[model samples]
Target: MQENLPRKAACIGGGVIGAGWVARLLLAGVDVSVFDPAPDAERVVREVLANAEHATARLISAPLPPQGTLSFASSIEAAVEGADFIQESVPERLDLKRRILGAIDAAAPADALIGSSTSGLLPTDLQAEMSHPGRLFVAHPFNPVYLLPLVELVAGGRTAPESMERAVALYGAIGMKPVVIRREIEAFVGDRLLEALWREALWLVNDDVATTEEIDDIIRYSFGLRWAQMGLFETYRIAGGEPGMRHFLAQFGPALKWPWTKLMDVPDLDDAFIEKIASQSDEQAQGRGVRTLERIRDDNLVGIIRALAAEQGGKGWGAGALLREHEARLRAAAEPAPAGEPLRLMEGEVDAAWIDYNGHMTESRYLQVFGETTDALLARIGAGADYVAGGRSFYTVETHIRHLSETKQGEAFHTTTQILGTDAKRIRVMHRFHGGDGTLRATAEQMLLHVDMGAGRASRATPEVLEAIAAIAGPQRALPIPPEAGRGISDLR
Candidate 1:
């Protein structure tokens, strides 16, 4: 997980994988230049990017970086020109890939890192024609690339060790889990695993043992769920009971020698067999187009990732951990308050979960936002996680909130905080909540006591904290206090 993003990137092809690369790069705030000769290249990229944006917005809660600019160049040279990073996602033909990579190497800067989106081709072969072969490496990613976080980074004979290091940082910075392959091999790890299962699946269908739908259901309902979280060996370890993995493996390992799978053979894809598979696949779809099915896949992926992120006391599990870490990075990378403005530290849309039966933003969420705003203020005054870890922090003692407007689900909103006053032992603050259109929606005023966690009582804050508080308090004192600052429920009536 790195925080530094590539300043500029180039996509050598704009097909599904190429467009996916563009979406991920642009969302991470890197300017992208793409080149694809297909007549529908721009349209394809736009549609894919739109889907990426929609799915990503629902997947994360942290403030996203402003989207970077996207451009399509007429030639490979034009696309790679001055790019700090370049990804080649052209069709899987060796000659085509070699030519494209060679052209990119000729045009891109000497220090630029180049990655190939080849699924099975060897990186050594792909970089054969390149003038700067040391910069090229395989960066294989799964389909719907913007959502899937796994990207295998495989180095070739000529690839520099530093190139692998840079590849991990660049891809990890964009929220990807870059697993470096220890040795270069065709199809790599993930695809090789899939190929074995796929071979067996074809045999099952060819022999009329099961329909495609049944095969899919079996995996999705059983090991698929397990693999999504715990993975294979860990999932099997649970099956071992009190004895653990050794017992499980001893019982099942010998079964691997049984003639239960056709892993060594592939079903003949003759005309009839092809039609049988296609017809069954069509029946499984039941009439959904490619894009509809794509959205469905994206939505399901988002749900799983988010659920994983919420597991283990919110530290996240598996891919969810990656999402959580990425969210933290995004929050930390958020631009600070412009010099004189009230600290605009938090803003987000009303999530569906935040809505009430009345179809409006619920009251609890109002307090939640205010609570988060106070957290932001505390962090500004040098009382963040580390400060609290040292056994002291500000504790909110009283709060008064007045909701003046109704906000429905999906309505964008922001909050601004001002320090009304502060002392060695106490602080007073107010937060104004507004809609995206700048309409004031609500107000909250809070009083906090600086406390020593070890003592569980009021205590003077550190001199450094007091100085930080004074700096903001001194400037905010000139602004008139909000009318609802200290009001009670009766005063509103």
Candidate 2:
């Protein structure tokens, strides 16, 4: 686990959101102590935890740290005694929430942050009675807290800026994407947008325009897919086409006043209306359990995110990019010390998609990893994309891979690159792969020849390239040559 990730967290409620917080914290390798007086808290927490484990395993490809312990505390004081962070997810009632927040504040350590899972309550009112009110703020998370990465941090009038900073760091370390609300306003950002959409949805239903399912389909099939990667503004910026946002607004902004939307007020939730919505929802679900639906949602989300992640270079364009950044952070946190013997070149996990019928990483994935490591070495030796584009590059001539142990999905692996031998036109290197706990799993020996791609074949002796290789090979010469290096197919067999 990373240093910033909380080691001990106290969850002050055990309903959906509370249990979700527990699931997220525990899975992120944070020990959790939960305090909830409700009789069903134990059962509910265990169920959500169980569901979270499977969904989360599919969500992240990196090897997660061993899950931490969970304990049920009898009272708030018992739970918050030594907690690094405390989160309160009590009922929505303002008085009930204030009492719990105040209790958590009085019982928790001065340094332990106290966050409320209130979706809309003003942090100002919630923290008014707390002892250290500065530590109390709203950290509103979306439902199914184990899956959704967005946690809105709303700092109250008395809240310290450092408190929000710590809260942001803690959430981010747990693989969440957090956005700080500039103002401590009710409903935060996401929910406020959702509320408006919900109001319009209800109005549409009340006017007999669209069924619940119809409305859902309209979003999911079209703009919803686009929104998953690019939000409203960017999605419409493309709509602007050859022109930019200003032209887009000039063309479509007038529609805002067309009275086509029923968004100003919400439709009344009368008995007949409630039943109509409920019946439609039940019909849409078609007897599927919530757990079943959750699994379906997770699988779909995984596919969508993986597709976006494939887009590689971008600034906050998609969840896939965010997922990649998260994995990078996790790898950085879990990377082993270099020990000064070999240069660590690549550290990665067997992504879920790489596993094959044998339940181990596919052979192609091994080559992909080695290829990545070689690319890394090239980039390090001043032969990056720009350099390659200049017509000088190292082209791999041969590779010898020795598969010593089977690696499975979610298994963390790292490679150390050792320059076996180098000359002006050719460089030979051996890459060793080790499991997360330091077991050597595989090895690869590759021979690359420097080429002038614009001219036909082997040509080199470039001063800069030769110097960079010598810089790496010079020190590596002191390390004994690997046993796996220089072996042919006949010799190894």
Q: Estimate TM-scores for all models.
A: 0.86, 0.78
Each model's lDDT comes to: 0.88, 0.83
In model 1, how large is the Cα lDDT of residue 185? Answer: 97
Sliding window of 10 residues with minimal summed lDDT for model 2: 331-340
RMSD of each: 3.5, 5.3
Tens digits of per-residue lDDT, candidate 1, 184-253, equal: 9999999999999999999999999999999999999999999999988899999999899999989999
What is residue 310's positional error in candidate 1, in angstroms? 2.9
For model 2, residues 1-493, the per-residue Cα lDDT tens digits are: 2778887999999998999999999988899999999999999899889878867665664546778899999999999999989989999999998888888888888899888999899999998788898888899998788877789999999999999998888998898888999987779889889999999999988889999999999999999999988888998999998887988999999999898887778878999999999999999999998878876776677667767765743222467767656755654555443433566766655667788999998888788778867876786678855687688888899999988999987677778788889888999999888887899988999999989888868987489878987887887788898887878776554
Model 1: clashing residue pairs? none
TM-score of 1: 0.86
Candidate 2 deviates by what RMSD? Answer: 5.3
Q: Judged by lDDT against the true structure, how good is candidate 1? A: 0.88
